[model samples]
Target: MTIRTARDAVTAAALYLKWLGFRDIMQSPERPASGIDLRAPGLVAQVDPTTCPATLRDVECLWLNGLSASAVSVFFSLAGYADDARAGADALGVPLFVMDLTGTPQPVNRPADELVSTGAGA
Candidate 1:
């Protein structure tokens, strides 16, 4: 049961959200340099597999918008990228959710407090 990349995770997330009554709001604009991958009504989500510095800023914007809109903010990533996602979410005062798309859809929602660790100290 090898886990795949974050894009795969996000695609799985989109399918799950659809199953849970969410429609496909928007897709990436196919820009090679764009940071945002998808944009849904009331929610902004991203899939990250690397510690790319750009992801932090991108997630921050998503977090702020998601918070303002009272949306269920999410970041789907491979296990390795969880820390980076959490850090970005914390700085933006938003929640970072984790979804194990590799198996049975085990999703974990980490609030700001829980993700604020001394090492990462948000």
Candidate 2:
């Protein structure tokens, strides 16, 4: 299914997480007060459904949230990410993925590649 809306993005993200072997996945409200889109055992995820690409602040926020929860963090963006955001994600070891319209998220960085190879255990 084409991900045309935020709700579609959330649904796709949740499904993708499931495919990645993440169990007990929990989705946040359409507009989550915490800005986190999803969560699972040992994981925290942020999905950017906006037209604007995710920025460095976005990446950092995801990292911070995950750190506070003592879980690994991942990011998904429909519009992709800014250069600085990518750099920050790389430095922070936060996995980054580009959420294509097909509802499949493609890895955008090395950490993300590792995540794909290792599944949820990473």
Off by over 4 Å in 2: none
lDDT of 1 by residue, 13-122 (tens): 56644554556556565523434455666556665545443256656766765677676555554443345655766665554544554623444434533432311222
Global lDDT for candidate 2?
A: 0.91
TM-scores across all candidates? 0.53, 0.96
Q: After superposition, how far is residue 78 of candidate 2 from its true place, in Å?
A: 0.6
- The prediction achieving the highest lDDT against the true structure is 2
In candidate 2, what are the lDDT values of residues 1-122, reduced to their tens digit?
58988989988988888899999998876677667989999999988999899999999988999999999899999999999999999999999999888988999999999999999976
Q: Looking at candidate 1, what is the lDDT of residue 110?
A: 49
Predicted model with the maximum TM-score = 2
Question: How close to the true structure is residue 114 of candidate 2, measured as C-alpha lDDT?
Answer: 96
Using alpha carbons, what is the TM-score of model 1? 0.53
